[model samples]
Target: MKNAFVFLATGFEEIETLGTVDLLRRGGIHVTMVSIMDTCEVIGTHNISVNADSLFKDVDFSLADALIIPGGIPGSNHLNDYVPLKELILQKEKEGVILAAICAGPMVLGGLGLLNGKKATCFPFFEPTMTGATPTGNGVEQDGNIITCKGPGFVFDFGLLIVRNLRGEETVNEVAAAVLAPGY
Candidate 1:
């Protein structure tokens, strides 16, 4: 099975992270929970804790067809500052890999020069940093291989998006039917 690497770091939004994991798994995509920290346990922004499958230094993110980043303060900053991870992000995007970030995460991608001329969206807090991002009130935005979403409230939409991308329209429709959610 082709893997989708969902990068999880400390201070991640629980719902945004979990929502994507659940939604994409339902669509039959192999979702791997990768830790960006030294340990496998990551604490969420809401004070919940989730365990990761592996440490950031241990995996080859390049094996992933797509890269996903959930949003949080300073966590976004942490992802942007990690040299190795940043290299992986740029390298993957350069190779036409699907890159996704949500909420403050778009700022992380923008910091890496991914959102310069692309139509992207993020949590309202980072709008000033986006420079020229197009706002999508609906939550999720796909700009080429860069997929973004607003925040936790939009996690479901964002996950459905990953489903649509990895599994195609037919699978999205089927999962949407199973999920009983309007947006798919």
Candidate 2:
């Protein structure tokens, strides 16, 4: 089974974070929610609190097939400010592991220079933060091992794209159908 890790921080977008996780799980992907905060309980931007599967320091993300980041106010900033998570993200990119982000979360990747020469998209207002990437205003953009999208509205597409990349088209179709989503 494909293993994926989603990083959680305070103020993360509730829909973006949970929706992606739910879809990934439905696709039969093993997903671990890693909390960047000191505790496994994370508070979302909309005041929803979720208990993560593990703390960031307690997990070995090196074995993950993909790393996901959800975006929101200070959540993206929190993830960006955390030096260790930034380091691990860079390392994962260097290893060519799939990296996915939505909304402002892509700014974290862009800030780390991972989006250089890649086609990426983010919250429209945050395009300037995408550094060297060609900003596509699409709902989702998958450039090589990197996947980026605009916001919570595209969470399903983001999650489904991750499913498609880690599993296959057949699995994606099955999962989408099972979820009664727009089937491909």
Candidate 3:
């Protein structure tokens, strides 16, 4: 099975994180929720608390096929500021692993220069932060190994896209049908 790590820092967007996890798991990916904070329980921006499957330092990411970042206020900033996470992201990029982010989460990629010369999309206000990237302002945009989405409204599309990238269109179709998602 393909393995994926979803980072859960404090103040993460509940819908984007959990929705993606749900979809990926349904598509047969082994999804691991990783907490970057010192504790396993991380609170979302809306005050929802979720216990991560593992701490950031406790998991081996060598098998990861994808690294997912969900966007929310201070959560995105925390992810961008975490040195270890940033380093891992860079390493993953060098290995050609898929890097996916939603909303402000793409800011982390933007700040790391990973978006350079790539077409990406993020929450409108963060367009400037995506240095060297062409902001498409679409609900979902995929440029090679990187996948980005606009915001909460597009979480399902974002998740389905990631599933497609990691698995295949057939798996995406199955998952989408199971979920009864429109326009699959």
Candidate 4:
């Protein structure tokens, strides 16, 4: 089974984080919600509290097929500022694991130079932060091992894209159809 880790920081966008988790779980992926904070309980930007599956320091991330980052104000910033997470991200990149981010979350990859020469997209205002990337402004953009999505509005598409990448187009179709998502 393919396993993925979704980082949850305090100020994360609830929909982008949880929606993607839901979609991936529906696609038969094992998704682990990881909290960057010291505690397992995380509070979103809108005051929604969620209990993460594990703390950042507790997991053996070697089993991760994909590392997902969801965007929101201080959440994205917190993700960017976490040294251990940044180190793991770089290591994952070297190992050719899939990396995905949405909205302001791509800035973390951009800041780390992972997006260099890659076509990526993020929430419009964060485009300038993607220093070495060519911002596509698309709802979703996938370049090799990296995938980026615009914002909360595209959470389903973003999640579906990750599913398509990790599984296959056939699985994407099945998941989409199961959810009654139009234009799949």
Worst 10 residues of 3 by lDDT: 123-132
RMSD versus native structure for model 3? 0.6
User: Can you write out model 4's per-residue Cα lDDT over 1-184, one digit (the tens) per residue?
Assistant: 9999999999999999999999999999999999999999999999999999999999999988999999998999999999999999999999989899999999999999999999999999999989799999999999999999999999989999999988999999999999987678
Write candidate 3's Cα lDDT for 1-184 as tens digits.
9999999999999999999999999999999999999999999999999999999999999999999999998899899999999999999999999999999999999999999999999999988888889999999999999999999899889999999998999999999999998788
Name the weakest run of 10 consecutive residues (lDDT summed) in model 4.
Answer: 175-184
Native-referenced Cα lDDT, model 1? 0.81
- For residues 30-53, could you state the per-residue lDDT of candidate 1 as single tens digits? 888888888999888778899988
Candidate 2 vs 4: which has more lDDT: 4
Clashing pairs in 4: none
Model 1: worst 10 consecutive residues (lDDT sum): 129-138
RMSD in Å for all candidates? 1.6, 0.9, 0.6, 0.7
Candidate 2, poorest ten consecutive residues by summed lDDT: 175-184
Candidate 2: Cα lDDT at 63:
83
TM-score against native, each model:
0.93, 0.97, 0.98, 0.98
Q: Candidate 3 versus the native: TM-score?
A: 0.98
